[model samples]
Target: MTKQTDSMSKQVETNKNAGSEHPPVKEHYKDSLEGSENNSEGFLAEVKAVKRFWSPVWIVPILCVFIGLWIIYEHYSSLGPQVTLTTSTAEGIEAGKTRIKTRNVDVGIVESVELSDDFSQVILTARLSDGKEDFLRTDSAFWVVRPQIDKSGISGLGTILSGPYIELLPGVSKESNNTFALLDAPPIAAPDAKGLRIFLESDEYGQLAAGDPVLFRGYQVGTVETSAFNHETKKMKYQLFINSPLDNLITENVRFWKDSGVNVDVSAQGIRFEMSSLATLFSGGVSFDVPKGWSAGQKVANNTSFRLFNNRTNILEREFKEFDPYVILVSESIRGLEPGAPVEFRGIRLGTVIEAPMNINDEQIVKNDNLVIPILIHIEPARFTELLGEQFNVVEQYEKGNIKGLRASLKAANLLTGAVFIDLDFYPDDILVQEKQTFANYRVLPTVSGGIAQIQQKVMLTLDKINKLPVENFIQEATGTLETSKETLVALNDTLHSVNQLLSNQSTQELPAVMKTTLHELNTTLEGLQPGSQGYSSSVQTLQRLEQTLRELQPLLQTLNQKSNALIFEAPATVDPVPKAAKP
Candidate 1:
């Protein structure tokens, strides 16, 4: 373009001169392009010059200082070093928002949940406050406290949804890497983390939840951590976190059952136990009591078997496989019983039953194509054991020796529902009172012990009594008396026949007249002898006696004459009329 301008140089020079004259327009045009390369270079140079004069090296240091301060603040204020706490109670506990507090001061944050190496306890990871280095103790007790209930009594079931608070019991052990145990509340027992995991099954009343109390002799000894259903076994599984101190108290003889009332059946003795109370109306719990003397202590009964019973269902479970009252294994027969059908022990209510889920029994019985529930019965071992014997004093006083007063009882079992009852002083004469169903082949139970054995003996004695009565002698005596009465009637009938024959014979009738004359003569002689019989007075006496004798004969003749007249004449038939109707 420049070369082309050569020819036009002269023109261009003239144009340039013109352009110079119009410098304002060119400048204005250039100025319109505010971002022109030349202007941009000049602006850059000016900026460089100003920077060379006034730029500050101190600014970088200041900024660095500020950034460091900010980093320090973040490090100090943010959640601290990560820590983990394991507790028995997940109750009253929440994640993320839960805080681990030491003397009411926030110490750490719950990070996450993890499984312990032993697989016994739940591990909760937490980030402790940066400055808080010491809080956990080796012997620090940990428990998750929520609303709970057990053998000891009913308590909170309230803390489940609420967040958990960590209570740090500062310890003196200086080990840097401490076993930071969890303390949800006061510990029931020191955690013996023996790596033992056990389960229990119970109903709403019988169930044990996390943070619920576990007790021995009414003293809290452990807590519940988690509850679940075991699909493999098909029963409920509740984990009991035991304290190290009281865990050993559980003995082979230590049996567990539900706290709610149920009917218990003692089948052989025909005894039933049914005790009801208001507490048993709704919720249930677990309870236990040792026999008066039968104990399984002195050695560890750790692997001992436990029995589960449901009085309501009348089911007895042989094994409580990790379950207390929850593991009641009902026989299929009892399992089929309807709800509200009572279970009785010697005529008393031991419990009532309900429909339930599958159980841990390897051999589960099915009926009617429906599931067989694991029957659960609520029982307070303490309360249940108290009723076996009566206060004998009352019975003793009731029996007065005067009339050979016999106080006997007959134990009977309900035929329809299998409940049992005791009939005190029942009269055997009333056969209707006894159950009609009887054993085809009756074999006595192990007549073991006191009043029960006496009852059995009495029953047998009654059987023998019917065999000793005298039926044949009474029959023979009745026959002899009937024979004698028959003879007497026959003799009387023969005598009447003879009299009729005499009346029919004319000659015999004449003989009757002669007998009458003889009787009159004898009467006259007797009267004369009794009156005066001297020679001179004899004649007079004879006359007088004759008159007296005639008078007596006259009365006899009159009677005979009347009888003859009646025989000769039939009496007239006449009807007696009612008195004339009163003047109507």
Candidate 2:
């Protein structure tokens, strides 16, 4: 068989060299057998014939085929679920090159990018890796991640060099979805992060933004996750995330406020500057704390709402409870009585002024016709609410107290500082009754005459009295009196001069000696009328009475010479009260 195989092989080789078809099998075998008899060893003669369509030599090509089939299967099987995202614009995206990532992990690639039917938005079709199709759920969020700088802070910095990509935040739901609207910017904080979300509402947004820190005391415990303006409420709503454990600190009574970077206060105490943190200076932040004097309330539920105060004091002032309101009708200046000023009962503050002073015009004049300053004051019962008990309503109690002479007045809280506050007290006699007497809403609290007002009124009255005095008439009367006195003094001086010349003459000197002798003779006769004599007693009594009469007449004569008209017109009584001497 070996000789036969060799002869056939040789014949086949000669046929391939000649580039010709093989001869007939009968002739070829005959030629092969003849050559086999002359061959040295017959290996083919010892081998048995096997009937198999597939041979061992065919294994190489079959294995290659199997590998090719496997590669094709894998190419299709490994392909992920396709998702389409609609974006505002296709500025930074490129088909087949852009990728989708979650927490920086590459999970998908963009397959194609096309504009919508309306050309208003760009649609992105992307293929997510196998087994990740479950991530596309109802709550799934997708946004284009690119370098962005906003009031919140710088974000997507990694995309600066690597180009833009789509970011995905998987939802918590079991359900799945494919199509989604792309966000213009990334979500403030990842929704899937383990934490709690609470909302805050404010009238002003200020520098607050997403990704700003949420602080407890001065340390950052969480962040402001998202924010949106609510038109219905006319407020800006913010979503705050507090990381686990620390979130336990939040209670129903917790007060939240914006950390407006730098805190500066210029007061009589001087300027004070404080900063919560450097991060807050850039991105701004939200801070919260349980207000003092209030118990830690119940643990807050997720998405609980609270007010976002603009300053720290506002949060601290949350303790005030406005259960009632009263209008302080001030006639004096309210220069320092601004809104938010404290309203005190005695020295303790019980409430605050919620609104600015309102002016009330009137045709009727108060005293000197001054327009009254009407201010709306909100009085909180919380300060004394507990003392009054829960059964009693503060508004009702105030109305009752008002009838008992509870009044509101403005007083200078700080004279040097010019700060004024409302003082509520009981002034029974000075209860200013209002024309409209009803406690329907805010009662009009009566105001007493302030100290300053009384002083002003007294000064005005004194000036009026001074204006009514008759000064002109008095001056004329005094001038006439002085002229009469001048004439009398000139006449008296002439008489005195004449008497002096007569006494200086030689004959007048002898006349004074003769008068002295006559006086001596009269004295000798008077001496004979001794003590205890009726004549002597009568003389002494008469002399004493005459001296007393002269002394009384001296003041009467001086007044008669002076402004006698004043004594006649201004005296309380013109009739003489001094009794006449009795006739005995």
Candidate 3:
């Protein structure tokens, strides 16, 4: 066999060198037989098995395996992180269709939507794009974005046509998370926004809500991020964010008050109308500022707690710290006096009414016959500091005033509203009590009956006095006098009737003609005395003659007097005296 193989190999090499396809089978067999005969010692044929490193059949399977590996790498490389999202409701979410976005940029898609184990919530498995896994921080927020109209105004309007999607707000926390709870509403402020966060507590919830604007001097500077009510504390707590530089304005002494947009103040001064803005008018907001007479204190840090007042006036009322408390025992009814009533000194507010008609048990009421209603009031020394100096001691001043007959009385503040306030003034007429008085542990400030109560009391006293009088007897006497006057009047009427009858007689009627004839004769007689009439002219001539006669008689009378004197004794005629010069 070896000799045959060598002969065949030699024949194949000769064919290959000749560049021929093959040798004839008969010639190849003859050559092989001749080579075998030439080998005298016929070698044992050694049959060696041959093996191949590879085969053509393996090409298809290897190509298929490579293709599968490439496909698997591509599938895994393209996939991002998977996160589980939980929400109360699956309102707008859909499996494989819903997308997650941040700042309106698509970032992920919901792979599946399923119910929680208790079926109380919707769970969504969302797949984010490559490298977006970093956004899944512990504090990250997620919510559905849809058309919403709220107190803040219209938002998510674009989602109306684009369809609802999950909104993701990346948090600042370094810790990563794969599961998160969905928010019902979008956050008021961006997580990364520069601002200050604060907490406010209020006794009442008021009308404030999340997304409400926070105003500084009527200008928006922040927003209400969250609002929650505590069942245990019974207070409404609010989380607020003041933007950037505006946050610097917040101080320890600053006040926060609810802005119901429109402020209508019906005070003793007058009705004042104030509005923050048109936007706030429809949607209520909050306002902050340092209250009047208060100093802006140090800047507040994050999460600082503060009190939220109902209104600006309430904040001002609470700003004073240095004050003294006293009680006023009022005998009159305190119908219009309420807590927070102004305690004024001659129309200037010096204090606030802490309580009207202090709480008293039935036993106390029964024990005291003349039970005067006790009014608790706080007199702030700060109010008088400007006038009485900062060193003024409220208690000292109160004691001094008490000794000098300073008293409190209820006065009508607004007649239309029937509101009353405590008035402080000196009333010397009130019975003086030298001893200090106290009621319910509070120093008593003497009170006097004044205002409407005094008037009512006086009226009641007058009515009582009148009631005590003999009114029936007075009425009877008045009736008797009236009857007598009626009789007198009847007699006067009879006299008048008789006079009328006398005037109505015929002679009485003809008296006018007789009087007229007399008047005519008198006129003729009077005309004779006139200068232009005969009587007047005669009188004038007679007077002239009388004057001439008197003039002629004057000389005769003088002569007669002189002759009579001469006859009585040697009548001497007086000679005319001549002027003479003074003797030298």
Candidate 4:
């Protein structure tokens, strides 16, 4: 260690001499430090002066702030208006999932659903699209669309798969709104839909519902929107819509009828069947038509009212006018006459029977001098107003008692049915007019006796002839006459016997020859009167005269047995009649 120390000391001395020759290490380091300091100080001064506010720190912070603000603005701008809707219930709805649609296009979403304060209805809060704020209005209608099957028809079929949705039919209002009442059911037709609205009045309110078609000339032109019964009016009111130009067909005089089904009519011509369409068969409909030879009248205004007929035939002859009443007095039985029996004028319908035959309950019956049946008939002159000009007045003629030869008669309408009707005819044969007396507010018109009356009069005449016969006196006279004739016949026979005896007595031999000559002359006369000769015709006439004389005598014999014609002729008896007080 000592030797090393001595060597080091010698080296140290040498090194010291070397350090003195070179500059000291501290001095060199100090010079280098000064030069570096000078350069750093200048560079530091230049950089400090050139510095600006656009540094990366400032730029990064500013960018971060701008991005945050943009994000916040986008979040706020994307939000939409909130709307509240009241519904009967919130069935088939989810707050976030339920969508509001217009024509199947999403317009809004349900933000929340809760019960109302009264708990009577469900309140729903929805967020509508940004620009759709104007769509929410006082008149806009909203309803929850779900799977529905009803009498009207099936609807919301898409809701079965995609879930329930709120449907909105926008209104025509220009004002904006945020709250709305939900509809329990969809409208038959949108209130703002393009159409013309009209009303119909009917006595019968048929089973008609919303969406029922309205037909014109068998083509569907519109729909029935609603129907209600009016208690005060005792009529059914139907609200309807006719789309577009089809409404132009409606007029004041147009007639509407319920299209129930096929109509069949059996008339003199043939059977007629009318049908609108098959759709009308299932769903009830209304049909309209205008009568021929009539103007269409004024255009149908909004909610114009019309009467609804049950069928087409009823509307054909619906108009009727008042009539004048007349009473017909009949002497014959009016068994088959009844109220509503037609009163005809020469095979033309003129009136109807209002009251059938009944016993007269007034002094007129006593004056009539016959058991009379009074029939009341109503005559409507308007039915024949065209045929009978305005100057022809029935009342004036009746008052004048001339009625223009109009007279009433009873005639058989149906022989088998025993039905009869009043027949008014112009009785030219009996035109002597007489004053008509009023009875029961009706003019008393004379009725002519029918065919049956003539038979009755003839029977009465025959009965009178039979009653005039003096049958008892004729029989008594005939018996006396026959007795007298019997006595005369016996006396004549005795005379004939006496003559025979005298001729047989003596002096007849020569007389017999003379008698033969006379007989020969008689035979010659007989031969001349044979057939094919004028003498034969004269002989026949003589025989006829003798037979007529015999017939005259025979009446006396007939008077002895029969009494029918005893009083018809005067009978002369050969002997005096028996005394009234003669013995038995």
Name the best candidate (by TM-score).
Answer: 3
The list of candidate 1 runs beyond 4 A from truth reads 1-79, 83-103, 109-127, 131-226, 241-248, 261-271, 274-283, 289-298, 301-307, 311-413, 416-584
Which whole-number lDDT from 0 to 100 does residue 212 have in model 1?
Answer: 58
What lDDT would candidate 2 get against the real structure? 0.76
For candidate 1, the 10 contiguous residues with the lowest summed lDDT are 439-448
lDDT of each: 0.49, 0.76, 0.82, 0.75
Instruction: Order the candidates by lDDT, highest first.
Output: 3, 2, 4, 1
lDDT, candidate 3, 242-327, per-residue tens: 99988999998898988887898775434667777665788788899987767798998999999998778777677576778888
lDDT of 2 by residue, 1-584 (tens): 64456766776667668876534544666655576667666433332235589778999999999999999999999988999998788888999899899988999999999988999888888999998988899889998888888876688898889999988999877888999998877665565777788999999855477778898888888988678999998899988889888888889888988897898754322356877778788667888888777789889889999898877766756645345677766787777667777877666666777665654444232434766666777777676565555433433555655346666677766666666677777776754564434222456777776655676689999999988889788889988988988999999999899999988999988997999999999988788677878888888999999999999999778767665775666634456689889999
Report the backbone clash tally of model 4: 0
How close is each model in CA RMSD to the real structure?
A: 24.1, 21.5, 12.9, 25.9
Per-candidate TM-scores read 0.34, 0.57, 0.67, 0.47
Q: Which residue pairs clash within candidate 2?
A: 3-36
Q: Rank the candidates by TM-score, best first.
A: 3, 2, 4, 1
Compose the digit string of candidate 4's lDDT tens values, residues 1-584. 34433544464466567765323433443454455575533311111124366666788889999999999999789877888998787888899999999998999999998987888998899998888877778778898888888766798898789998999888778887888888767776676777789988887766566778898878989988778999999988998989988889998878888887677754322356887678788766888889765679988678788888777765653344678878887778887777767777666666778788644565465445776777888877765665676445454465575555667888777765667778877676766654456776667776687655666689999999988999889999999999999999999999999999888877775788889999999999888888977899988999999999999989668786666556776555558678688688
Q: Model 4: which ten-residue window has the lowest total lDDT? A: 40-49
